[model samples]
Target: MEMLTVLLVVIPLISAPITAIIANRYVAWLITLVTCLALAGLSGVVLHHVISGEVIHYELGGWKPPWGIEYVIDSLNALVAVIVAFIALITVIYGSKSAEKEIHDSQIHLFYAAFQLVILGLLGMALTGDIFNLFVFLEISSLSSYALIAMGQKRQALVASFNYLMAGTLGATFFLLGIGFLYAASGTLNMADIALRFDQFSSMTLVITALLFILIGLALKAAVFPLHSWLPEAYTQAPTMVTVFLASTSTKVAIYVLIRTLYQVFPNTYWEEMLLPGFLLLSGCLGMLYGSYKAIRQVSIKRLLAYSSVAQLGYMVVGVGLNNEAGLIAAIVHMFNHAITKAALFMAAGLVLMRLHTTNLEKLRGAGKTMPWTTGAFALAGLSLIGVPGTAGFISKWYLVQAALEKGNYVVAGTILIASIMAIMYVWKIIETLYFEGPDKLTVHKVGSGKEIVPDLPVATFCCYVMVATCFYFGLYTDIPLEAANTAVEVLFSTGGGQ
Candidate 1:
């Protein structure tokens, strides 16, 4: 089990350099696919152990906690790691055909290399027990992500990457400073150790200062609104597959870090005293409104979804801010729900880009006639995004509404419904364009055989269909995600904070 835990990070970390050195795009793609497959399998095993109530803790270099690097896999992180791995696998499969259209052939190998590194970084962040190590993994992911976004087809990609770099660096710096203050107060870098010693050496000043720094830093990374200036353009311009992977996993992983720090590292007394829950609730409500409003304004499909991500993130954060079992469960379950829902939406958009060569709402008119599979997948996923009953998105929102009302926070409950209505507006824009309007003749294209393609992009559309199915399957099944979330919530409350 320990070997499996270490291998999860090692496989991708090792494969990345090999892919880079090969300099063959196909080989790199193959290596990336294999690596993701292995990771997905390993993550499943880890999750199984976690579900069995075994916490897998491995001390790196034969040194004990507080003295050496450590990897910890509990119910919370195991679920997150599984999400990242499987999503990466799906993206890689879809990218096999989609990336060729968007990325230059010469640079594709390097893109795969960076993609592997991203997997390594996210998994490391999920599994690492040391705060400093989490930062290291965070940088590994951030730096590679910048490169990936910069590889977009448009020149604006460079500007977007630069903006993200600036924001990401500032976030990392804040996170590091928080770690320093935490080390000074607790004299240990291991998360569990910090929690154990928290009350012993923690001063009010150091605790508040550390919490603020960490929270702000991670909020930036998570693209929690007000600090999310880098997100829109970045998501809009990145290569389709890269955007898919990132939209599904990156910000969610950052939020996972915040969850770990609050629930596993800091004592219950610390957060309550800091009034963290109220602060999260207020900020989350604002983000929900702001992001949904902006999403309704977007004409570009990718950009519209990007803003929707901001609003969806607000829903998850609101769940956390409620600071109860239902809230935490909602947050965890939504992390999975939103990841797949957004991945499907983006995958569908990629199909549109492949066929029509644009995601412009006006240009995509009547795409449903030419590409019914893609349009249908998009509609299903969009329904989930709108939190319609009998979809994965509805389940998360249901729990969120229950949690908020349980806390006597009627405003939060109302805000959630309002956000759902706003989601319907933006999602309807794409649907109307795809189905209700006439196609622009200028956007049509033909293959070398002079046959115009219909029901375009089978492979990528299949991937999109897979995602769409999960959105509905999980909605109805409910047992897997609910069980994992319930276990995670139980563990978190057991460790510290109580309702």
Candidate 2:
């Protein structure tokens, strides 16, 4: 069990270079599939142990904590790890066709290589106990993502990737400064060690500065509004598959880090003493309304969904700020629910992009009649996004409303309802364009035979169906994420930092 920690990171780390060296695109994709499968299985095992109330702590090279690096597996990180790997697995399976279509044949292997590194980085960030190591992993993911986005079919992808690189570098700088300030204050870099000694230097002004820097850095990475300028273009310009994978996993991981740092590394009292909770609540509320409003106005389906991600992220941030059990549960469970919901939505969009070669609202008119399976999947996932009953999105919003009301924050509660209404508007825009309008006959593709045919993506469509089912299944079940989130919150708030 203990070896599982190193294995999770190592498998992908070793495979990445090999996949890059392989010239065959098919071979590279196969390696990626196998790697993701292994990661998903290993992550599930880790989550299982964590859910059973067992924490796995592994010292690097037999070095003890406070003096050497460590990997700590608790419910919070374990669940996040599972989400990352499972999404990667499904994405690799769904992406083979999409990748072949959008990327130059020469660059496909390199793309898969970068994809593996992104996984490696995300998992490392979740498992490592040292703050500096977390930054290292962050760079791994960010650097790889930049390259991956740049490989998109459109020329604008290069510009979008460059912009993302600039934002990511700035965020990493802030994060590193925070780590330096923290080390100066606590005389340690290990998270558990820092937590244990945090109080001794909590009164120092440097500690407060560190916390602020860290918060800003993570908020930028998570694309909280006002710092999300890079996301819309990136998600819109990147290849269909790249957008789907990153949309599902990247910001969610950043939010998980924010949750862990606030609740575990520092203290819940920081929420009160520094008035951090109010700041978060305000930012989150603003982001929610602003993101949703922007989403409703986008003509490109991909960009519309990009703005929608900002809104969904706002919900998670709001829940975090509420600073109660219900709020924490809302935040954590929403991470899982939103990952699947958004992935399904993006998957459906990707299918349309693959078939029609465009995601423009005007071009995709009447896609529901021509591409029924994909359109149906999009509609179902959109319901979840709108918080309709019996869908995963509803579960997240319900908890959020409960948390807001519990705190007597009627305005925040009202903001949530309003955002859902805004979501419905944008979602209906796509639905109406796809179903109610007439097909753009001139844009439809035809073969030499002059016969119209819709291409089939059996595996990809199946993957989308699987994701859509999970959205409904988890919404109804509720226990899986709730149990993990409840235990994670308990551990985070416990004495001794659950170490």
Candidate 3:
């Protein structure tokens, strides 16, 4: 079971090179799919083992922690690992036909290779016990993401990638510098070791500076408001599948790191004394309102979703900022729920792009009637985004409201409600476009047939179904995810009892 920890990172890293070497595109995709599936399965097994009271630890090259590299799978990391793997598996399946359409034929294999590397990097970040190792994996994922976004055919794709590169590099550098400060102060690179050693620091200034740098770096990476300028263009111009994967996983990983830092690395007394909780709560509230306001103004469907992501991230931050059991649970649950819902929505959008050759809201007129299933899936995901009753989004919001109320913060509860309404506005915009308007005036070109007809690829449709089913399944029966989230939260706040 301990060895399984290494496999999560090793499998995808190995498969990436193999994918690039493969001659056939189909074979390359097959390799990527198989590897992702294996990762998901392994993650599940590890999660189960952890739940059964096992802590899996693997030392790299047989070197013990505090001296050498180590992988630690606690309840929290295991849950996140499983979520990352599951999302990657779904994205890879969805990428098949979509990639073929959006990317050059000769570059398809390289795309898969980069895709695997991104997954590998995410998993590595989740499982590694060292802060420096986290930065290393962060760069791997960021570089691959830049390449993936640049693969888009849009004229602005290169520009968007370049912008993202600059922002992402700065964020990574800030994070690296913070880690360097901690290592200088604590004389250890291991996260667990640092946690134990952090108490030795008497200088509040050093701690504050380190925390600020890390928080800002992660906020930039997570695209938190005021630092999220790179996201809309990146999402709008990136290949649809790349957008979906990044939307669902990348920022969520950043949030995971934030949680680890706040609840695990820093002392509870330090957090409370600095008023970090209140600060985060205020930032989150502002981000939620700001992101939603921006989202409502977008004409491009992808850009709309991109802005909505900023708002959604704000909700997660609210949960974390609440700094209580209910708040933490809400954050974790929202993280998972949003991932599935957003993935489904993006996949549906990708399908529409396949048929319409455009993601402009006006151009997507009558997609609801022409592509009923895809459009229906989008509507379902949109409802989830709105926190409609019986959807996964509702559960997260429900908990968030409860958390805010528990703290006697009626303002926070009201903010959550207002954010939900804002989400409805943006979501309804797309829904109205799809259902109320007339079909696109342009003739549709058949995929691979050179005929003037709708191009409804089976692979793309299947991908949408997979995502939609996941959204609905997780929404109605919230036991598994809810339970996992609760357990993970328990681990986060157990030691720090709001002191």
Candidate 1 structure quality by residue, lDDT tens digits, 336-399:
9999999999999988887767888876777787777788999999999999999999999999
Can you give the TM-score per candidate against the true fold?
Answer: 0.97, 0.97, 0.96
Ranking by TM-score: 2, 1, 3
- Expressed as tens digits, the lDDT of each residue in 260-338 for candidate 2 is 8887788878546789889889989988999999999999899999999999999999998998878888999999999
162: Cα error in model 1, Å? 0.6
Q: Per-residue lDDT of 139-187 in model 3, one digit per residue for the tens? A: 9999999999998877799999999999998998888888888777878
Cα RMSD, each candidate: 1.9, 1.7, 2.2
lDDT of 3: 0.85
**lDDT, model 2:** 0.90
Span of ten consecutive residues with least summed lDDT in model 1: 442-451
Candidate 3 to truth, TM: 0.96
Error of 3 at 261 (Å): 0.8
